[model samples]
Structure formats: C-alpha cells, structure tokens
Target: MRILFASSEIHPLMKTGGLADVSASLPVALKRLRHDIRLLMPAYPQALARAGKLESMATVTLPGFPDDPVTLLSGMLPGTRVPLLLADAPRCFQRAGDPYRAMDGQDWQDNHLRFGLFARLIEHLSLERTPLGWRPEVVHCHDWQTGLAPVMLGMHETRPVTAFTIHNLAYQGLFPRHAFDALNLPPELWHYQGLEFHGQMSFIKGGIAYADHVTTVSPTYAREIRTQQLGNGLDGLLNHRAESLTGILNGVDYKEWDPGRDRHIAANYGPEDFSGKALCKTDLQDHFKLRGTSGVPLLGHVGRMVPQKGVDLLLRAAEPLLAAGEAQLVVVGTGSSALEQAARRLAERHPGRVGVHIGYDEGLAHRVEAGADIFVMPSRFEPCGLNQMYSLRYGTVPVVRRTGGLADTVVDADPAGLKAGDATGICFDAALPEALTDALTRALALYHQPDLWRRLVRTAMAQDFSWARSAEAYATLYRDLVAARVPPGKP
Candidate 1:
C-alpha cells in the first residue's frame, strides 16, 4: 500500500502533543509492514533546525494561498527510511513561538489561511505527484489541520481514497464565519453538510463530511464522540456517520519508551530485577529536592495543567495526601495560567513533598515514568493517552480515569482482575477528586503490598502497547477502504 500521511506536526519535526509522536512512529511502523509511506508536515523553524540535510523538491503556488511561495522539501524521517515532505513557506510557518500560537497563548491570527493553504498544498502534492512518480493509494489525514484535503479530494474525478484520524475532537479548527469568504473556500462548502458548523467554518467537518472513513484514537473515544457529552458539538454529525467511524488504539514507540535501554533516566531497569528502579526513585527525590527515603510513595504527572487534564482533581486530592506526607508529588509541563499558579504555590508551600516544573522536559518525563511508584492521569476525557501506556511499559502503575483510551488500555486492579493475573493499573470511574483520591488510596495500598505491586508491574511490562498491533489494524483499514471505494471507472 502507498500512503501520504499528512499532519500539521510530526515528532522531532514539530511536536506540540501526542499527534506528532503518532505521526512519526506510525509511518515507521507502517513502512516495516511493506507499505510505502511519505510523511508530510510544515517546515517550521524548529523542524527545519532538526531536519538533517533537506533537499528541495519543488515549488508550489496555489490559488487563494498566501502570496508567499511554498517550497516542497524532501528528506527521510530520522532513523528511518520513511520519506518526509516539508512544505517550506517561511512567512506561514517560520514564526517565533509555538506552531499554533504566538508568544501569548492566543492562536495565530492567520491560522485559517495558513492551514487552508497547507491543505491545498497537500492536495496539490498528492494529486500531482510533484517530488517523485509516487502517487498514494490512500491519502491519510490527521486531525483538523489536514481536514480540507479529504473534502477537496472527494470532488476530484481521480483521487486516492481518504481517511481522517481525529486525535482530539475538542479542537475542531473552528474559525469565524467570515473566514469562509476571506479564505475563498467554495461557497457550497458553507452548508451544514460540508465545512460549516452552526454558522462558523469548521475545518474538521470537512474531513468528517467527505472522507471515505473516519477514525478516532481509541474505541471508547470513537463511541464517546458520538454522544453530546464528549462530542464538543460534533456529536450529531458523528452519530449520523457512525457506521463509517472506527476506533483504533494509539500505540507508543516502545523503542523510545522502553525502560531497559532508556538513556534519559537515572538508571536502566526492565521487568526483570528492576533493582535500578530504586536508584531511579532516589534520583527522582534528589532531583526534586525532596527529603524522602525510597520507601515513600512518589506520584508523578506530566501533561497540561488544564481542567480537562484533571490536574484540578490531582490538586484537590493532594491537599490532604501531601499534607500527611504519605507520598511525594512531582509534576512537569505547563498550561492554564490559573492552574500553573496554583501548582507553583502548592510546591512553594510544601517545598520537598510537592515539586512542580512549569515546562516540558522529555528527559524528566522519562525519569517520572521510570522512577515513580504510581503514575497519574485523572483526565475528564482522554483520546488514547500515551503516558498510561508508557507507565505500563516502565512498570509504573497508572491511576487513571476510566474514559476513552484509558478505559481500553488499563485494566483496573480489582479483586477479580488481580486473581486473573491481568490487572495492570488502577482505574476510577468519576473524574471527581474523591474518586481520584480513592484510586490513589488503592494505589498506595497496593504499593504497601510488595508481592502484589510486583505482580502488577510484571503484568504491565508484559502487556504490548507497541505500534505493530496498531499498524496492522491500520493496514487492514486502508485495504478495506480502497477495496470498498467506488472504482475509478464506475461512479
């Protein structure tokens, strides 16, 4: 199979979240399955800096795009043979700060035009086979940023089958109603069935309405998005298009996440022995300036400090938990100004017991996974979370809310599950602080039981969350979509 994997971000190239990791790992995994895959993303300053020796392929000028010309750059995905394409338009992508945002947290003003042009760029490259003589059998779009490709492709007489994967539904690429006219999108796309959503232009709806198939990151999220609670206003449309929806769990690149050979952590340890984990714990405490012995339970969290992330729940529970000194909590990554202030304040008040870092560090993330006795994610809703899977691989028991991918990945350490020797982590139903605290209480109890803790860790390590499984599923999906689509000759 030949695939043009398109995304706004790809790890090491440009990453704001898990989508980049998926964009990087999935293609490499697919390539191993004998599929010819090409990765496409913008050539942001960060990506260009990291990209090794990019060769210019072609220059692209499209109708209604920004005046700046887009130069297509070709390279290989680092450490892999997967072909990489970068749309190099300096004015559109070479901004000072985050890809989607300015120095302040507000989104870039020209976002609609930028990604509108980007979508057109992808469509042009895939349609024309500009760089090389390889045309894709499937044009796989990721998230709302690439949503326009599928809609535009559906109108082409000769075009590859399209598949769109929604990494997170909450961000639907909504622009003001005027964007439809400003960006010069066809007036027809302003209808309810196309890109328009409740009088606003929604880039994601383009994919959902026109793609041959739609997918979310997890089976539970696939179902969750069809409901009003988690849909973020796309539920009705999703429910109408339910049959075409599929949920495939996101896979972590175990090669990068494996504890046995992880160079970022304090010590290397696998399921076997795991003695180095103690040293890692000591290092974690020392690094956080916590005066705690290895025996104290350490809770680790890494993600945005938002209400959705359930960091609020963690903070609420921490008030009582940290006060008693039963455990030490360490958190890294920044978001939500109020939450960031709250975290800093908590850390300041309880110096050693509560350590907080307001920015993301990959090395520290790996250390948290390897060193912590319990990993925490109390998400109100999650779409195929990667950290819980990472914690499982690192033999760090995850305490998570049973929603979306967390539900699919973690088997709660209940009595029956424990007896079956299949319990991998602790799960709570509600996203409330009480429920989270209860799960943490359970995790602390399990921590005291060394034999049980070891069992859980071994089971977690034994579980396979590798890309091979997801890649196979995606390969099968591509084949099914291609076979099921109307033949180029007929319709």
Candidate 2:
C-alpha cells in the first residue's frame, strides 16, 4: 500500500503536542508493516534544522496565495528510510517560535493562508507532481491543518482515497468570512453542506463533509462527538457519517516512554523489580523542593492548562488535598494565562507542597510519569489521551474522568474491579471537582494498602498500550479503504 500521512507537526523535527508524536510514530509503525508511506509537513525552521540532507524537488503555487513559487524539499525521516516532504514556503512557515504560534501566544493572523498553502502542497504531492516520483494511493490527513486536502481532493475527477482524522473537535480552524475570499475556494463551499459553519468557514468541516472516511482518536470519542455536548455543533455531520467513521486509539512510542531504559528518569525499574520507583519518587520530591518522604503520595499532571482539560477541576480538587497536606502536587504544562497564574498562586499558597512548572519539558514529563504515585487527568472531554496510557505503562495509576479515550483506557479502581483483577487505574464518572477528589481520595486510601497498591501497579504495568495493536487496526483500515476505492468491475 502506498500512503501519505499529512500533519502540521512531526516529532523529532517539530512538535506542539500529541499530533506530532502520532505523525512520527504511526508512519514508522506503518512502514514496519511493509507499506510505502510518505510523510508530509511544512518546513518550519525547526523541521528544516533537524531534517538531514534536503533535495529541492518542485515549486508550488496556490490560487489565493500571493506567495507563488513556494519550493518543496525532499528528505528522509531521521533514523528511518521513510521519505519526508517539506513545503519550503518562507512567508508561511519561517516565523519565530513554534509552528502554530509566535513567541507571543497569539496565533499568526494569516494561519488560514499559511495552512492553505500546505493543503495545496499536499494535493500536488498526492497527485504525484513532484520529482520524488511516488504517487500515494491513499492520503491520510490529521487535524484541521490538513482539512483542506480532502476538500481539495473532492474537486478532482479521479483522485486517490482520502482519510481525515479529527484530533480535536474544539479546534475547528474557524476563520472569518474575509479569509474565505482570500482562500479562493469554490463559491459553492460557502454553503452549510460544505465548509461554512454558521457565518464562518471551518477548516475541519471541509474534511468532515467531503473526506472518503473519518476517524477520531478513540472508540469512545468516536461515539461522544455524535452528541451535542461534545461535538461542538458537528454532531449532525458526524452522526450522518458515522458509518464511515472509526475510532483508533492513539499509541505510545514505548522506546521513548519505557521505564526500563528511560534516560530521563532518576532510576529505572520494570514491573518485576519496581523498588526504584520509590527512589524516583524521592528524586521528584527533591527536584520540586518539597519536604516529603517516599511514603508521601505525589500526584502528577502534564498537559495544557486549558479548561477543556478540566485543569480548573484539578485545581479545585487539589485545594482541599493541598490545604490538608494530604499529598504533594506537581504540574508541568503551559496554557491559558489565567490557569498559569492560578497554578502559580496555588504553589505560592501551599509553598513546598505544590510545585508548578508552567511550561513543557519532555524529560521532566517522563520523570513525573515514573515518579508520581498517581497521574491526574480530569479532562472535561478528552479525544484520546496519551499520558494516561503512559501512566499505565509507567505503573503510575491514572485518575481520570470517564470520558473519551480516558474512558477506554483506564479501568476504574472500584472494590469490585480490584477483586476481579481487571483494575488498572482510577476513574470518576462526572467532570466535577468533587468527583475527581472522590476518585483521588480512593486512590490515596488504596495507596496505604501496600499489597493492593503493588498489585495495582503491576497490573497497570502489565497492560500494553503500544503501537502494534493500533497500527494493525490502521493497516486494516488502509486496506479496506484501498479496496473500496477500486472500481466495481476491478479488484
């Protein structure tokens, strides 16, 4: 099978979140299955710097984009033989800071145009116009950044199969009406059956409305987004297309997350001999400058401090626990100015008991997973969470709200669940602070029972959330898609 995976970010080259991790790892996994997979992303300064040797391939031009003659660069993914395509449009990507934002947190005003050119590049590549000489039978896109590819593909009389994965529905890439004029899209796209959502044009709606098939990050999320509460007004479209939609949970690259060989943690241990976890706990406490013994429970959090993640719930739950000195909390993330300030204020209020690092550090994230007795993710809605999976692998029991992928992955640590020997972590039903605290309270109580706690840790460690199962599922989907694309008279 010949496929091209398109995403805004690719790990080790450029990254802002789990999308990059998926973009990088999934292709590698697919390539291992003996499929010809090509990876496509824009040439951000970071991607260009890390990309090994680059060969100029072809130049591209989009109708609305004034920046004509954007160059394309071809290279290989680092440490792999897989081909990589980089759209070298300086005006669009060669800005300061990361791919999506500048040094200031505000989005670049011309993002619609920026990603417009990127989608155009994908369309051209999917058509095999470049010198790289590989035509993709299937073009799989990720998120709203590549949403326009499906819309653009719809215009072709004989185009390859297209699949679009919605990583997050909340970020629909809603652009103003004026931007649509700048996009130079077909006027018919302005209708509700196309890209238009209310008064604005949605980049995601383009994919959802026209793609050959659609996917979310998890099976539970696949169902959730069909509801008014979680769909963000796309429920009708999602429900209509439910037959073509699938939910494949995101997988972790255990080579980067495994505790047995992790270079980031203070100590390494496996399920058989996890005595080193206590040392990691002590080191984590020391790093946070918290006064604590190994006996004290430590809760860990790593992600955006946005309301969607229910960070407010986490804060509210932490207040009672931190005030009573029941446990120590360590948070590592950067999002929402108000949440950042609130996390710092909580740290200040509790001094040594609360440690908040208002930024992302990959190494520190691994240490938290390896060290903390409990991993907290109280997301109001999670599509498919990666950290909870990492927590399970690290033997750090996760405390999560029963929603989306969190619901699919974590097994609630109720008495019946434990007795049945299937419990992997703690789960709360409601997305409320009190619900989270109740789950945490249960986790803390369970922590005092050494035998039960050790059993739970081993159970978590024993579970597998690696790429193999999910990759096989994707490979099956790709095969089905390719078969479906064949003409009725042909094989």
Candidate 3:
C-alpha cells in the first residue's frame, strides 16, 4: 500500500497535541507493516529544524494559492525511516510558537491561508501532478488542517481515495463567508451540502462531505459525534453520513511511553516489578515540594487545564481529600488563565498536599505517570486520550470520566471487574465534581487495599495498546477504499 498521511503537526518536529504523536507513530507503524507510508506536514521552523537532512523534491503552484510556489522537501522523519514531505511555504508556516497559535497564545491570523496552501500541496501530491513522481494510492487526512484535500481531490475525475480522521470535532476549521471567495474555492462548495455551515465556510466539511471514509480517534467518539450533545453542530451531517464514519481507538507508541525503558522518568519500572515506581513517586513529591512518604496516596493530572479536560472539576473534587491529608495531587499543564490561577491557588492553600505546574514538560509528564499512585482524567469528552494508556503502562491506575476513548479503554474497578481481574482503572459516568469525587474515592479505596491495588496495577501494566494492531486496521481500511475506487471516467 502507498499511503500519504497528512497532518498539520508531527511529533519531535511540531506538536500541539495528540495529533502530532499519532502523525509520527502511525506512519512508522504502517511502514513496519511493509506499507510505503509517507508523512506530509508543513515545514514550520521547528519541524524543519527537527526533520533531518532533506533534498528538494519539487515545486508546485496551485491555482489561487496566495504565495510563491511551494517547495516540496523530502526527508526522513527524525529517528524513523519513514519518508517525510514538508510543504515549505515560508510566508505561511515558517514562524510559529505552535502550529496553530503564536507566542502570545493567540491563533495566527492567517491560519486559513496557511492550511489552505498545505491542502493544495496535498492535492498536488495526491493527484500525481507534481514532479516528485510519487502518487499515493490513498491519502489519509487528519483533523481540520488537512480537511480541504479531500474536496480538492474530489474536483478531479479520478484521484486517490481519501480518509479523514477527526481528532476533535470542537476544532472545526470555520472561517467567515468571505474566506470561501478569498480562497477561490469553487462556488459550488459554498452550499449546505458542501463546505458552508450556517453563514460561514467550514474547512472540516470538505473532508466529511468529500472523503471516501471518515474516522475519529475512538469508537465511542465516533458514536458520540452523531449526537447533538457532542457533535458541536455537525451532528446532523455526521448522522446523515453515519455509514461512512467509523472510529478506531488511538494506540500508544510503547517505544516512547513504556515505563521500563523511559529515560525521562526518575526511575525505570515494568509490569513484573514496580520497585522503581516508589523511587519515582518520591522524586515526584520532592520536585513538587510536598512532604509525603511513599505510603501516602499521590494523584497526578497532566493535560491542558481547560474546561473540556475537567481540570476545574478535578480541583474542586479533590479538595476535601487533599485537605484531609489522605492524598496529594500534582498537576502539570498550561491552559485557561482562570484554571491555571485556580490550580496555583489550590496549591497555595494546601502547601503540602497540592502541587501545580503551569506548562507542559515531557519529562515531568513521564514522572507523573510513573510516580503517581493514581492518574486523573475527568474530561467532559475525550476524542482518544493517550495519557490514560500511558498511565496504565506505568502501573498508574487511571480514574477517568466515562466518555469517548476513555469509555472505550478504561474498565471500571468495580466488584465485577475486580473479581474477573479485568479492572484496569476507575470510571465515573458524569462530568460533575461529585462524580469525580466518587471516582477518586473508589480509587483511594482500592489503593488502601494493597493486594487489590497490586492486582489492578498489574492488570493495567499487562494491557497492550500498541500501534501494531492500529496500523493493521488502517491498512485494511486503505485496501478497502482502493478496492472500491471508481474506475477513471466511469463514476
């Protein structure tokens, strides 16, 4: 299979979230499966710096793209043999703090133009119109950034099959109505059945409407997006195209996340033994400036401190337990000024029990996974969270809200699950503080029962959420799409 994986970000190059990790890992996994998979992303300064030596492949000029010809740069992804293509349009992607945001945390004013040009590059590659001479049999697009490729491909009488995966529906690439005219998208695309949503132009609709198949990060999320509650106003269309939509749970790259070989953590540990985990916990406590013995229950939270992640809910729910000195909490992430302040305030109010860091640090994240007795992820909705899986691998029991991928992955530590030795984490049904508190209570109870906690931790560590199976699933989908491709001039 010849596949082009298109994303706006890639790990070690430019990463804002899980999409970058997936873009990096999945392609490597597919290549390992003997597929000729190439990764495609913009040539941001960070990405160019991290992506090793490169050769100029080709230059492409797309109609109405407001920039010089895009220089296609070919290289190998850092630390991986997978071929990498960077659409190098300096004016669009060369400057950035993150892919989507600037240094001051504002969305880049020209995102529409930046990603629009990237989509054009994908179109050129998919249609085999560029001098690079590599035509993908299938182009897999991720999130709203690459959403326009499917639509552009659809304009041709014949083209590669397209698959679009929605990482998060909340980030639908919506622009004002004028952007449609400004981008010179075909007027036909501005209809209700096309890229238009309400009175605005929606980039995400290009993929949803034109792609041969649609996917989300998790099976539960695939179902969740069809409902009005989680759909973010696209539910009706998703329901209309339900047959073409599917969800495959995102897989973790064990090479990067496994505790036994993790160089970022304070100590190394594995499923067979967790002696190093105790040292990791002590190190974590020390780093957080908390005075706690190894026996004290330590809870960890790592992610953006945003409403969707339920950071506020976690803070509120854990207060009583922290005040009681029954547990300690350490939080690592940055988002939402209000929530960051709240977390810092909580830490200040409880000097020894609460600790908060305002930004993301990969090493600290690893330590949190390895050191914490319990991992907390009380998301209102999660597309396909990787941290819970990481925690499980590190023998850190996860307490998560039952939604999206969290629902698909974590088995509740209930009596039935415990008896069957299938319990991997604690799950709560609601997003409220009360629900999280109850789940934390359950985790604490299990933690106090040393034998049961040990059984649970071992079970968690034994679970496999690796990329081999996920890569195989993607390969199958690509094959199916190619098999079903309409013959040229016959459709």
Candidate 4:
C-alpha cells in the first residue's frame, strides 16, 4: 500500500515528545514490511538546517490560504529506505526559533493557522497526481496538527481513505469560529458534527468526525476516552463512533532504544552482561551531581514536568522519600515553572539525595535509564508513554500510575502474589501523593530483596514491544481500509 504520513514533528530532525519518535520509527517499520511509505513534516529552519543537502521539488500552491506557495523539499531518511517530503513555508514556520515556540518561550498564537495550512497542503499533495505520477492510497494523519488533512480529504470526492490517530486528545487544535472563514471551508462543514466545537473550530473534532477510522495510542486509552474523565470533551463523539474506534498500542524502535547497541549511554549492557550498567549508574550520578553510592536506589524520571505528568505529586512525595533515606532521585525534563521550581527546591533541600536537570538531554536520559534502579512515570493521563518502555528495555523497573498506556504496560509488583521471575514494575491506582509514596515504598522494599530485584529487571528486559509487531497490525488495518475503497470486481 502507498501511505503518506503527516505529522508536526519527526525524530532526529525535530522532536518534543513521543509523537516524533512514532512518526520517525513507524514509517521505517512499515517500509520494511514492503509498504510504500513517505513522511511529510513542516520544514522549520531547524529541520532544514539539520536536513542538509536534501533535493528540492517544485512549488505547489495551497488553495485555501493565499500568499503562501508551499515548496516541497525531498530527502532520504539517513540510514533508511524511506523518502521524506518537507513542506517549506518560511513566513509561517521560520519566524520561530523552535518548531512551535517563540524565542520568549511562548507558543505561537498562529499555531492554528500554521498547522491548518500544513494539513491543507498535505491533503492537496496527497490528492494530486504528480507529473511523475505519485499518489497515496491512504493518508495517515497524526495528532491535532494534521487533523485537518482527513477533514479536507473527506471534502474531496476523489481522495483516498484517511486514518487519524489521536496521540493525545487534551491538545485539540481549537480556535475561534471566525477562523473558519480564513480556512475557506465549505459552508456545510461549519456545524457541530463537522469542524465546529462549542462555537469554536476544533481540528481534532473534525478528524474524529470525518476520518474513516479513528485510533488512540492504546486499547485502555481508547476505552478510557469514551468516558467523561478522559475524553477531553470528545467522549460523546467517540461513543457514537465506537465501532470505528480502535486502540493499537505504540511500539518502540528497538534499534534506537536497545541497551545492547545504544551509544548515548556511558556503557552498553544487555540482560546477560549487566555488569556495565553499574558504571552507567555511577556516570549518571556524576552527571547529575548526586553522590555516587552503590547501595542507594537511584530513581530516574525523564519527561516534561507538568501536572499531567504527576510531577506535582512527585514533588509532594519527594521530602518523605528523601527522609526515608532509602533512595536518591534524578529528574530530567523542562516544563511548567511550578514543577521546575519544586524540583530545584527539592534538590537544594536534599543536596546529594535529589538531582534535578531542568532541561532535556537525550544522552543524559539514556544514562539515567541505564543507571537507575527504578524509573518513575506517574502521569495523570498518558496516551502511550515511550519512556517506560525505554526503561524496561534498559532493565530499569518502572513505577507508574495505573492509567492509560502505563496500565497497559507495567505489571504491579505484588509481594505475595508475584512469582520469582515474573514481576516487572510497581503501579498505583490513585494520583495522590500518598499513593505515590506507597508505590515508592513498595518498590524500595522490593529493592532490598536482591533476588527479586534481579528477577524483575530480567522480566522487564525480556518483554518485547517492538515496531515490527505494530507494523503488521497497521498493515492489516491499511489493507482493510484500502479494500473498502476498491470495487469488488476491480483488480
């Protein structure tokens, strides 16, 4: 099948979260399965700078928004067979230093317009038969940034089947209804069942309503989103289209994350050769300025620091954990000033016990995964977390909130019920600080048992959640969607 993937970010070129990792790895896996896959993303200055010496394609004009002629840039993904198409529009994309951020750390207010243009451009490109005669049989749209692509495809009678995957529903691309006039959408599409959402234009709502199939990142999340607690106001719509909704768990790129081959960490070690991991732990302690200690359990967390991440709860439980004097904490991420300040304050209060690196460092994150005895991800609502999977791959037991993909992945460590070599990680149902403390205490208690800890690590390392499995599932879905479009007698 010929598939065109539209996303806001892709790894190695641009990234802020797991969406980039998925956009980068999924295509490669699908390509390996012999599907013709191509990736499309905005050619932000950073991306263009990183994607050096790529060939440029002919200019194409997007009809809905005037004065912006979308230029197509072509490149081969490094070390892969997949082709990449980057939409170049400097006036809209190049104004910012980061892909979606201004110099002052504020999100660009015109993000709705920016991504709307990108979505329309992707739709136009997908529908057009090039002079070289290239067109996609299916267009896979990711998140709210590319949500309008499916909506636009629905408007076009000749367009291919569309699939929209919601990585997170909380970030629906919403703007004032007046912006619909700027979008120049058809009059019939302005209602609630279309792009409109409670007097505003919601890109996510449009995708959910118009796409042939809608998917979330995990089965648990897909079921969770149908309820008021997790829906983010789209529960009713999802409930109405329950038959079309599916949850396919996200997969990790083993090549990028495998402990056997990762070059980012200080030492490389797999399940069999686990001795090098201790060196990685010491390296992590030095990097984070935590006092190097062999006996103390080093807990690691690598993600955006926000209430959604349960960083607030983590903060509230920090002092108690430090006072227990059983473990040390090392956190790596940047988000939400309150969490940052809280992390900094904790680091100050317990100088050697808490280490806080207030920004993202890919190398440091890998070291932390390799070094830490336990990894914590207490997200209040995670769509499908990749960090916990990474931690598992590195033999770091995850301590997570039993929500979304976290619940799908981590097995709660039960002392009495757990078999010798079966337990993987710790889990808690509540998002409160006390729940986190209890979960941490349970993990700490397990850490005292050397045989149990080793067994848990080995169990986690043995788990497989690679992209090849997910690619096969996606292939089945694509075939089904394509078959629906073809006539019964047609070849």
lDDT of each: 0.90, 0.90, 0.91, 0.87
- Lowest lDDT 10-residue stretch of candidate 4: 124-133
**Which sections of candidate 3 miss by over 4 Å?**
486-491
Q: What is the TM-score of each candidate against the true structure?
A: 0.98, 0.98, 0.98, 0.98
Deviating ranges (above 4 Å) for candidate 1: 129-131, 486-491
What is the Å distance of residue 77 in model 4 from its true position? 1.9
On the 0 to 100 scale, the lDDT of residue 93 in model 3 is: 83
Q: What is the lDDT of candidate 1?
A: 0.90
- lDDT by residue for model 2 (1-491), tens: 89999999998899788898899888988999999998989899989999999999887675567655688898999988788988888888888988878798888888999998889888888887766677888999999999999999989977789999999999999999998888888898899898889999899999998899999999999999999999999999999999999999999999888999999999999999898888898888889999885467999999998999999999889899888888899999998999999999999999889888988888999999998999999999999999999999999999999999999999888988899998999998888889999999999999999999989989999988889888899989888988888867874
lDDT of 3 by residue, 293-383 (tens): 5567999999988899999999999999988888999999998999999999999999988889899887889889998999999999999
lDDT of 4 by residue, 145-247 (tens): 8888898888777778999999999989888877787888898899978888889999899889989999889889999999999999999999999999999
- Mind sharing the TM-score for model 3? 0.98
